[model samples]
Target: MDDDEHLLWQRVLAGDDDAFAAVFDLHASRVHRQARRLVEARADAEDVTAMVFFEAWRRRRSVRIVNGSVIGWLLVTTTNVARNRERSRIRYEGLLRKVRVETVPDHADEVLDSFMRPAVRGRVREAFDGLSTRDQEILALCVLEELAPADVARLLHVPAGTVRMRLSRAKSRLRAALGEDHGRSTLAGLGGTS
Candidate 1:
């Protein structure tokens, strides 16, 4: 939150359209950059970025400005939006897999492998499945969405310090699950000798 941002927020809160546009101009590029890093698809990133701004506009009253740090809020929102998109993609892929399994017997293995590794991918999914829902969401938000810990905390409505602690626990659990001899065997069975 810089001085200019603070000023723009003041005007936005005062109901100035120009001030709102200024806010968009100031932060849109950074938002897009963050989205691109998370989504890895140009069009998807653009759409997500637009949704972030739209959300900001819709929730303008709730957007409090403390020392011009709206960027953190925006980043958190963008991360959540990106995560939603990822979830939607996963569901769509699952439905598609079900359809393909029923209609096309020849491509079942290939379709499953496409969703994950032929053999190794299952271990990865199993490790993820072992985590609690909150742990999984935190991991996806921080690791897959690539958001900063502070931003993740804001999005989850928890303290930044709590985010750090939860992330540490989640990492430890994932590492333990992935490091056991059985996990190693599973990985090997997936055809990844290493």
Candidate 2:
């Protein structure tokens, strides 16, 4: 037996959380790598890794340590967990296919479904393009890049209030170009207001 591993396992058996954490830290990456080899998605591999550790902790008393290390057992459990998850996923996909349903989108459904309409996007782009170069720069920095007004002012070598004013003017011009109601609705829809 590896004396360190034997001691750690004994501590784990004695219900030491730190010992279990140490064991997990020692083996988790190896288990995750094994799981990644067996599963298609990184997320699925991560899930399998978590389940392997959970199973180890849940059945700690029965977990077999091989060659004075628990890694061999953890790796085997990782494979089993990955296989079980893959089988469950296949069954779920099959059931979904059997019960597939289709529905036509209504106007409200269509509006809610899409983030922005193509026509609205075109108009917004056109409006943005029509702005002066300075306005465009200010808008891009403040809104698109999500920079703070103070940061933008520092970057442009201007006062913070000047940056805010320029941003306000750019937004006003865009709103005017898009028309009042349409612009407000569009901005609100996109989770922004000016």
Q: Report the number of the highest-TM-score candidate.
A: 2
Per-residue lDDT tens digits for candidate 1, residues 67-138, read: 666888899899999999999999999998888444546786776566556465666778989999988888
Give the whole-model CA lDDT for all candidates, comma-separated: 0.81, 0.87
TM-score of 2: 0.54
| Worst window of 10 by summed lDDT in candidate 2 | 185-194
- Assess every candidate by TM-score: 0.48, 0.54
Q: How close is candidate 1 to the true structure, as a TM-score?
A: 0.48
Query: Alpha carbon lDDT of residue 115, candidate 1?
Result: 50
- Give residue 99's lDDT in candidate 1 (0 to 100): 85
Q: What are the root-mean-square deviations of the candidates from the true structure over C-alphas?
A: 21.5, 7.8
Query: Alpha carbon lDDT of residue 177, candidate 2?
Result: 84
